[model samples]
Target chain A: MAKTLTQEFTKGLWEEIAPFRLVLGLCPVLGVTTTVENGIGMGLATTFVLVFSNLLVASLRNIIPSKVRIACFIIIIATFVVVTELLMQAFAYTLFLKLGVFIPLIVVNCIVLGRAEAFASKNSITLSIADGLGIGIGFTLSLAALGSLRELFGANNLTIWTTPTSVIGVQEVFGPHFQPFSFMVQAPGAFVCLGLMLCIMNLLGSK
Target chain B: MRELIKMVIVLTVLAVLSGGLLSGFRNATAARIEVQQLKFVKGPAITAILKGVSNDPIEDRFAIKDGETERKVFVGKFDDKANTVVLESFGKGYGGDIGLMVAINMEDDTIVGAAVTTHSETPGLGARAKGDPGFVSQFKSLSINDSFKVTADGGRVNAMSGATITSRAVCAAATEAGGIYQRMKPQLIEKLKEFNK
Candidate 1:
């Protein structure tokens, strides 16, 4: 039986939520969320990669040999990542530098491949698109949530928009003295933020 | 036989698709990637020093000399009034090279400002290099005559509680970069005129 479209669109929120429930793509979810800007850049870049890879993979799912499907998934995801990385460089160069290796690392994010293997292959093109969208949004939201907490607690203020200084007035509140959270921006803080967020998510889900 | 033929065709198609995609992406984003690398790593340092100049820093190329060691400086720009040159410098820290961009002012031959690009110092210890702008801000308004050394080293720079090594490395790089730019001052002015013209 053909499943309803709603299921496809809603699967990523609670069921596959990338980092929390599915436990996939946690590396990036934890690694990049030091501040709001880093988290947003990382999330958007991942979403771009995820959406494009899913679309292409589902379209070519049947043609891809089962034995070489993993290879194909990697290529498709890498292509999208490169494209997104370039776009970020051209337009938002500063944010792009801040994100660093994580942009390329998106190729290995399990969420992209997981969707291709679990859902895209079985679904229609439109449904696959929906699934990709849902999952991408979920991942981005998770990153931003983690980033906001880190930025607020780690730093005095949050810097979401990554311009030089002329963003929706982040400088006004934070001013020049506003310092970033040294630990939160580093590797250790990634685990802490994700762990705490995951706990809270679990608690909220139970309630 | 038919299945074998189909599998070969599929594999061939995948290879062609991947190759085609990778080549296109590499070509399209190569320049952009280069620019981004310049902006983040070196851009802020230029801004910190050239705060008053109407024009953007000269982000073409330059050089930094440390003792006998010389490294090519890229994405560099020059300002005419201050007769300064901003270049990328890598200071040796506990973990690795601490990347910084320093502005050399020509008037008094002082370092105007420096913006750190990257570092791997221990958190709350060496990482204070970034967290404490005081560590970085000290670079502004200081001249070569002042001696860019930490207070412990008989200079004005104040080392952080835990990041004595990193602070010293930064001071060393800033000092070296300032020395090199002073020698290159005449050429820098000529180059700035050439670039602007």
Candidate 2:
């Protein structure tokens, strides 16, 4: 069945959210989500890349030969990733420093490649853009949710954003008496947190 | 035969276009990126090393051509006289290169302060060189001409516990800064004169 434009856009939010539903692009989901600020910054950078790459891939889908399409998609995706890196370095240097290698790794993000190959290349430009925005926003929300869960338990604070001069966030939600579970911010913590979120997602979906 | 030619042509065009576009964007953002780095990465280190100075070291900076490389030299004004200059040098660390910013008092040719600007050393171990002030504070008041070495290598500086390699790397960077200062003393003095006016 041919779906309407709104359906195409809304499907990514819940039905095919990258991290939870589709479970694609888990590297940044786990790696950079140690803090809420890092998660949002990383997500926005990835979204910028996704939207542009989808737009280009869909536009050039006809011109791109089948045999070399993957290579073409990569070239397109890589260009946007570098653009993101450079812009982040110029404007958001602090976030750029935090994101570091993960910025460039967006080129290899399966969500980007998978979308370009499966949806963008075959779909119309408007539909491709809708899909890209939907999936990208979904990915960002997932990272933020997971980041808040980990940071709340691990550090006893929620950092919304960090400017050069001041940090904008709640300093201590649990108050002074609460001792933070430091393990929730570490590598193993990421895995456990992700698993629990997945379980919760599955339980909700089962209904 | 036609299909093969089409593939080659399509790939070549896409690669060339992507390269041209990225290179253009990189050139446009290069200057802004440098300013951002100075502000976020190197600025704090310079300020910490040149503390109590009457002027901002980051703003009162000049570049000197040392051999083939042009090095940035930040000037600090003390009591209405610009007598100290900070130079950055890098040494190989456990994981990668560690950048050390060394400040020298031109009047006495002695070290003012040294701080790590950028590094990729192991967290809690080698990274203590930057995170902890105890290690770098020892570089103060030493003659800029002297070569630095850790206690394990028969020198006065003590290596951080469990981070001997990082300590040595910092020592090497300080030594390098000393060499650069000695080599460029005359030019640096002239540059400081420009800032005084």
Candidate 3:
């Protein structure tokens, strides 16, 4: 009567994307993605929170009373988010500032809560962890794919993961002196990138 | 009754755990956080100024005091050049109080570095005054006695398109800071020795 772990992992790629398919956590997906670097940072942090929270909620489902389950889920999620925020501030201060409030806002991301309510509440602990992993990876890939395209076209460079040190002798190739395109780093560019990515994703899924 | 008691106990435990975690983090990283903050605020801009110059801003401080104003303004000497001082000023812009930190030379009030630390400015346009080279570079080497104005007002700097109000506000703040420095040169010089000690 129980579903296999492989099905749990595969479901996240198309059936429940946490963004395009489930239509969850869209605010941050668009907010912090001015550049591919910020997008990837945000994506990985969010995936970490989602996986951990999902696993925690599933493990505690039976112990918590149904009447207060919603409140319990929120505390667990918030605890993990606080940990993520502290780690970013300590180790990734630059990215932490660039991503700003979106990092802390992970507590409210519907993806985590939705998983808790829909699958974690009823699924086996092992299956719940699998679901979390599948969904987290799918979300991270989607973000990186969207971010790379935005950075390449909007800024005319592939700056997703390179540090400043990597550019020591490479400035001439990137630009005479690379000027990040102001337009692409602003809010309107978010919509442009999301729309183009959405269209491509739809086309690929259909064919 | 028993369920209610358990609920209170659970909520209390959760709150304590979260608070303790936050406080522990704050204590452990306070010094490193302060150092990072100081570097982020002034390091890059000051370094950019000293790149081709002989002096470093951190080593030297400016000593200036004007007899008339009675208020002293000390410009820190770096590598023996009196070129940079921490400035405090704010303007009521279209957004809100825009507080700034500016570093300028005592001899000429030529800005060594400038940063707007607080502003609720228009996202893309007004905020560009910080990121846009055309805007930031305008303040460099500008004589304190010289007018701070947008090119439209017969100055050298261009007005940020769609952001003329914010642009003027920035210029006004810069001018005020410059005038105060000149007015208090005598007292500022004397105070630098005291403050530095």
Per-prediction TM-score to the true structure, in the order listed: 0.63, 0.84, 0.65
The parts of candidate 2 lying over 4 Å away from their true place are: B52-54, B65-70, B78-81, B90-99, B108-111, B119-183, B194-197
Candidate 1's residue-wise lDDT over A1-207, tens digit each? 676777766777667788887778888777778777787778778777777888888999888877777877777777788778778878888787667667878888888888888877776788888888888888888888888877776765678785676764153245667665678766787788788877887898787
Ranking by TM-score: 2, 3, 1
- Model 1 in CAPRI terms: which quality? acceptable
Give each model's whole-structure lDDT. 0.73, 0.93, 0.69
TM-score of chain A, predicted model 1, versus the true chain A, to 2 decimals: 0.89
> Could you give candidate 1's per-residue lDDT for residues B122-178 as a string of tens digits?
767887787577778888877754548889999888888778899998888787676
lDDT of 2 by residue, B87-108 (tens): 9999999989999999999999
Q: Write the per-residue lDDT of candidate 3 for residues B1-197, one digit (tens) a residue.
A: 98877777776676686678777877787767645544564455455544544544444444343444322222455665444565645666677766555666765657765556546677787877656757656777777666588888887777889888778878877777777767665656565555446
DockQ of 2: 0.79
Q: What are the RMSD figures for all models against the true structure?
A: 8.1, 3.6, 7.6
Candidate 2 global TM-score: 0.84
Ranking by DockQ: 2, 1, 3
lDDT of 3 by residue, A1-207 (tens): 667999899889777777776667788777866566777788889878878878888887776667777888888888888888777766666777677668878888888888888888888788988898888877877776666665655676655564434521122235656666666656787777777767776787787
lDDT measured at residue B179 in model 2 versus the true structure, 0 to 100: 94
Cα-based lDDT at residue B61, candidate 1: 60
Candidate 2 local lDDT, A85-149, one digit each (tens): 99998899999888877998999999999999999999989999999999998899999999999
